[model samples]
Structures are given as structure tokens and as C-alpha cells.
Target: MKSFLTILFFVAITAFSTDTVQSQTFPKMDTSPMDLAMARPDRNTPPIARVIYSRPQKNGREIFGELVPYGKVWRTGANEATELTIYEPLKVNETVLQPGTYTLYTIPEEDMWTVIINKNANVWGTVYKKENDIVRLETPARNAAAPAESLSMVFRPENNGATLMIGWDKTYVEVPFEKVK
Candidate 1:
């Protein structure tokens, strides 16, 4: 009877261990990792703006106007909400946003896209609050030369500011922001 009890205990322990491992073994399926930063031309200055997001692949499927519909809030990327960290106060279009982290969201349209900076940095999927929006600016949407297999956000440095370029599939948009004096 003691041997039988020991065998049962070992079986239970193995089962629990297996369950724990399985729970933690979930894969990062999206795969496209993106990190973009805008820094001063001087080497001494640290990055003034940074963004981290997971990129989802096209996989031969329709993206803009279909997978991502128009006039709806998009999380801007896959997995955890796309995060933007600004170390200095900047003017996005005409709206001023203070230095802080924000979740980037967007509404895609054929002619234009509305880029949103939201106060909530910890959100998943398309869950967003309009009340939490810090600023929203509309930018022109244009066709890309070639289809981008994966989503991408790049920061193009300028003399006084930067342009945030977002591209996926065949569509792209640019948002300009400048440091506040």
C-alpha cells in the first residue's frame, strides 16, 4: 500500500509539472519585432522618442480596408498594445503631448488615417478609451511601391523633429512631431 501511494504521488507531481510547463510554453506567433527610436544628431543625447510593438505578417491576406477596416480603432499592431515613449514634450501636428508613455492607436481610411496617442499604455487588442486619448491627428495615406510582408514603424529624424512612418501591406502613412521650445 505504501508503494502504491508513492506511485500515485509521483504521478500527480508529474502531471502538475507538465501542466505548468505547458502553460508557460506559449509561443510568440506574430514574430515581427519592431523597435524604433528618434534621437538628436549629437551622440551625447539619448533617444527622445521610442516605440515598441510586435509586427504581424501579411501572409497573403488582405490587410487595409479589409482585415483592418476603416473608421475603427486599431491597436496599431499585434499582441500587447503598441507603446510609444516620449522623453520630452512634443507637438504632434497642432496638439501638444507631454513627456510620457502612450499607447498608439489608429483608424485607417483610404484617403487618410487618424493617428491616436492614448494615455493608457497597458491595453490589449482593440480595447481603447476615447476619454483616454491624449491627441489625435489625421495624416495622409499613400500607396507603397511594394507590399510590405510585415508591419513596420520607422522614425525618420529631422532637424527639429521626426516623422513616424507606419507601413503595412501596400499602404503607408507619416506623422510628424516636433520638440516643443
Candidate 2:
């Protein structure tokens, strides 16, 4: 009888220990990306684009199209759209986002260029953000430039160093520094 009780006691202890150990779950952060195609190829190459960023980005206030402007399609992030790159899925301004990829487009002016996130993954380039899926988050665009017509999806690395620059014509707009992991 004593041995039986001892066995039962040990079983209970092991069960409790196993439950305690197994119950612990890793905490999850609220970062959900929309995960769309970051880049595509030229007409013949079938090129593939990769995702780039530092890690741990900031979510700030301001309507995307307001501070960011209205009209042009944006890359959604510093360079490309892959989930949170679209609207609601990932917070662009101070707004809470859902998580999804979007093609970003814009209409450039003196101050802002109406940053937009489109739903189209297969595009010729950062061309028509308006004609794609219109979901979005607006952020203020910054003034940065390269002399000639630079490719749109570029991340110039620096400190935490991540900048998504769109340069076509002499004019340019930048969505700076995204913390990526």
C-alpha cells in the first residue's frame, strides 16, 4: 500500500511538472506583414526580388495619404510590399494594421506624393498604384534624390540604415528607415 501511494505521488509530481513546463508559450509581437512580391524581373529574365530591412520598425501617427500625400502608389514600406506593406494589415501611420502585401504607388508634387498600396503583385514596375487594390496606410514622404532615373525599390543601408527611395525624373520621394528582421 505504501509503495502504491509513493508511485501515485511520483506520478502526480511528474504530471504537474510536465504541465508547468509545457504550458509556457512564447509571446508573439503584433507584427503581421502582408507578404507580397517585393520585386519582379525584366520581360525576359524572370527576375526575383528579395525582402530587405534592418529589424524593429516604428509605427507613427498621420494619415498615409495626408503626410505621405495622395495619387502615386507606394512600395508600402521602405522598398517593397509584402503584407503589412498594404493597409490595415500593417500600420503605416499610427493606425493598427491587419497584415498583407500591397504594391505601393505615389503622385509626386512639391511636398508629398500620395503614397498608395495596391493589391497587384505582378506589375511591370512601381507604375500604377491607383489601378491596383486601393487598401493603404499613409505616411509623410521625405525629399531624397539621385540625379538620373533610379530604380524604385532601393534600400540605401546606413545606421539602422534602411531607406526605400523612389526616383523617376529629377524628382524623388523617400520612405525612410524600416526595422526588419
Candidate 3:
């Protein structure tokens, strides 16, 4: 009986161990990692706006007009489309954007980029609909002083609000935002 009990215990341990190993198949880390950028008047103040996006590495490959393609809407980053959250009403290119969460999409070009603010937020992939667009404005794109290995976005505070700076590879663009009156 003792021998029989020992065999049962061994069987139970093996079965549980096998189940544990099979149940946990950890996924590999993403090549493109998600990141966040925010704008604030000062370090002690609350953020006026925030952006969440993924930073995709250049990997020594062509970026703009090639990997990203020109005249096409890009997610602005890898994986999920970039998300923008506005804490207060702000104006972009004279157009007022009410306080809310939005998606930032861009139509890349050789010398210019069309920035689009959409109503949808936190959606997966680059699934875009023209009807959801809130505003679209043109911003000039220029070559960066040095190649950026990863996609990056930063907000610089101004007297009115802030300017959103986006750079990838060897190109960068600035989008200005001002507090609404």
C-alpha cells in the first residue's frame, strides 16, 4: 500500500508540472516598445496634453518615403496608433480642439506632412475612417541633424500652450498647439 501511495504521488507531481509548463508560454518582448510624452507649463503643474505611442527602431533601414511611405496615413508609430489626450481646449492651426482624447495620424510627404486629429482613441492598428477626423493641418517636415534610431515625440511649452515635436530616422516635424480663448 505504501509503494502504491508513492507511485500515485509521483504521478500527481508529474501531471501538475507538465500542466504548469504548458500553460505559461511567455511571449517575446516587442521590437517596438510603447512610450509616453506630455506637455506642461512647469514641472509643478499638471500636464496640458499627453501622447502615448510606440517607438520603432530605424534598424538601418529607410524610414520616410520608403518604410513609412509618402502620401499615406501612418499610425505615427508602430503597433497601435498614437493616442493624444487633451486636458483643456487648445487650438491647432487656428482650429480649436475641445478637451478630449484623440488619435494622431499623419500623412507623410517628401517635404510636408498632413497631421490629422481624429476622435477615436486607444484603437489597435491603423484602422482610420474619414468621418472620425476632427481636424487636418499641414506641417513642414525637415531632415534631422542626426538620424534617430527610434521614433520619438516631445512637447515644448510655449506662452500659449505647447509644440509637439516628432522625429524618426532623419526627419522631424513640429505641430503647434495654443490654448483656446
**lDDT of candidate 3 at residue 51, scale 0 to 100:** 96
Q: What is the alpha-carbon lDDT of model 2 when measured against the actual structure?
A: 0.44
Tens digit per residue, CA lDDT, model 2, 1-181: 9999999999999999999988886677535222222432233633123333311122342333454345544443443342324221223333332345445555544555655555666454344545554534344445444433222345444343234555533445555433332
Write candidate 3's Cα lDDT for 1-181 as tens digits: 9999999999999999999998898888899999999999999999999999999999989988789999998999999999999999999987899889999999999999999999998878789998999989999998899989999999999998999999998899999999887
Ranking by lDDT: 3, 1, 2
- In terms of TM-score, the best-performing candidate is 3
* RMSD values, in order shown: 4.6, 17.3, 2.3
User: Highest lDDT among the candidates is held by which one?
Assistant: 3
lDDT score, candidate 1: 0.86
Candidate ranking (TM-score, best to worst): 3, 1, 2
Off by over 4 Å in 1: 1-44
Pairs with backbone N, CA or C atoms under 3 Å apart (clashes), candidate 1: none
The lDDT per prediction is 0.86, 0.44, 0.94
